[model samples]
Target: MTTPATIPTAGDEKLPQAAKQSGQALQTAGRHTTQEILTFTIGKEAYGLDLLTVREIRAWTDVTPLPNTPPFVRGVINLRGAVVPIFDLRVRLGADATEPTNANVVIVVEIGDQLCGLLVDTVSDILALSDDAMQPVPATAADADHNFLSALATHEDRMVALIDVARLFNRGVPQVSEAA
Candidate 1:
């Protein structure tokens, strides 16, 4: 039998003003309009990305290791004949890496013209949040790991870190060989 999909639990964080107003509008109209977000888990926290940007989610597959590659770069996988680099989300989040389990999933996403797979602990369900559900990233967030986040979304009690796909490979990380 196939495994059941995981869905994120809404938390208590307050929504941003814009999202609040939008939520209010939807509530009054008896309808809600929300953007679909593909949520996932990294370390102990929840994160999400725009579903439109996600191409596919695959189970953990054998990665072709590259010499001199950074530890976070789990290596590349032949995704339908096209080699796509995969990065371990745990390492990228400054967490200790763990062995992949049945719950692990590789989230393949396209940012601009570059395609990359994010190795996450598990794939959560698609979150549909009204405009008011999103919140602004705090100033302190700028001081955190540069590549750790790009945006923030609040749902009741939890804050979801929006991955910045473009900056996933920061300056400190070894660049993938163009010749590959």
Candidate 2:
């Protein structure tokens, strides 16, 4: 049996004092709800995704470019005999295309029945954040780009924008990949 003290977490040390106290109380009873997020950086911004959606993280490798594909679709790579399309997240998020390098990585994630890779500058850290730390996306930004993000979480005095992969890539979309 795992005791509260035995359970490890990164957010426990960075939570607000009061929230930390409350978290400890909940932890003691083994009832704490910690949201695990996979954080990564694109250019200068921090972004996060639900850890549950992530399948695996792979080092950047050359992909076979697909003709007629959108700019964001950098092409696909064969993962264990399965062809997975790689999307340049920086470009998809309205930034310039990322110049692939050794520092870059592909975050393989499953959305619905589709498995795809998100090309990011670097894989930051997997953080366990409390629900209270997550705030709704700004009203103006949400209204303008409703599907782009789910929420904004504050950790270590930094804001990590939570990417809503499902909404961002809309189900059964040709722009993301071919029907599979």
Candidate 3:
């Protein structure tokens, strides 16, 4: 909500180099280890996640509704034979529901032993950010949105909020039981 993420234009040679380098806070020689972040948008605002957690990125598709769940729970989609639940990132951030369209995308991510997809407006840049580049979320941001953001960092004059995967589902994904 602070600022919309700045996306790199095509033909920018720097992007490839940034994308190639990434990690999950790992240590490295000389400089701090880089964390590769996958950036995406929800409306105009941009958000990012540690690339190590991402499973894949797929086009938006209709999902089968579940009986009882939160409004943010868009429903479940079939990924191969596996049923993956999709969450509306907008709603999760306490914003309006996203009107699904062909342009939308599902970012499949794995947290611990669980797997799920995050529905967003579109996918953008993969940034290679060093540890020192990241700053803790400001204490002034005491709102519904603050709980979800782990840190904030700038990439090309744009601010990208690093989402904490552990807090996305409060550390536990819904348990889907088998139907006899």
Candidate 4:
């Protein structure tokens, strides 16, 4: 079983603290800002998110489906008592749905004040890249998937689409603010 000590959540400040200890320098000598990205796979394509926003990684677990939600929304999972909505990355990107397998993983992240989970095929690398290494998303590729990408970064000769977490979910992750 995975222990809490091994996994870092937003409540556990250890992650950012340890990261700061190692990456004390956020900027390079030439005034270039360095950013850390957590890359993962939806299918064959690669995607990434800001490392600072990632909370924890969980093995694929059965989620309780909700009614009247989009197909992309796989459902919600209770994480330490909080209901975190999980979205299937493949379906969200206009691809076929994913069949849950032992190899799948759920990446919990903070979209704002709420916590949400992104269901992905596999977790890849944690890359620290400079701002200049990232290229802006070309306007020509505008679409549902394209709109979600803020930048395209290359690492080890592979292009990783950096997702704009905030821009996803036009209505935001469904949070139960009050009794409906």
Candidate topping TM-score = 4
Where does candidate 1 stray beyond 4 Å? 1-33, 141-144, 170-179
User: What TM-score does prediction 3 earn?
Assistant: 0.80
RMSD of candidate 3 to true structure, Å: 11.7
Q: Write down the TM-score for model 1.
A: 0.73
Query: Residue-wise lDDT of candidate 3 within 25-137, one digit each (tens)?
Result: 54456635678899998888889999889999999999997767888889888787778889898888889998999999999998667678899999998999887778888
- Sort order, lDDT high to low: 4, 2, 3, 1
lDDT of 4 by residue, 34-78 (tens): 888999998789998989889999999999898888898998888
Candidate 2 lDDT trough over 10 residues, lowest sum: 22-31
| Model 4 misplaced regions, further than 4 Å | 1-25, 177-180
Could you tell which candidate, 1 or 4, scores higher by lDDT? 4
CA RMSD of all predictions:
10.6, 7.4, 11.7, 9.1
Model 2 misplaced stretches (Cα beyond 4 Å)? 1-32, 141-146, 171-180
TM agreement with the true structure for every prediction = 0.73, 0.77, 0.80, 0.81
| Residue-level lDDT for 11 in candidate 4 | 54
Q: What's the ranking of the predictions by TM-score, best on top? A: 4, 3, 2, 1
Q: List the residue pairs that clash in candidate 2.
A: none
lDDT of 3 at 176: 52
Residue 68 of model 2, lDDT score: 77
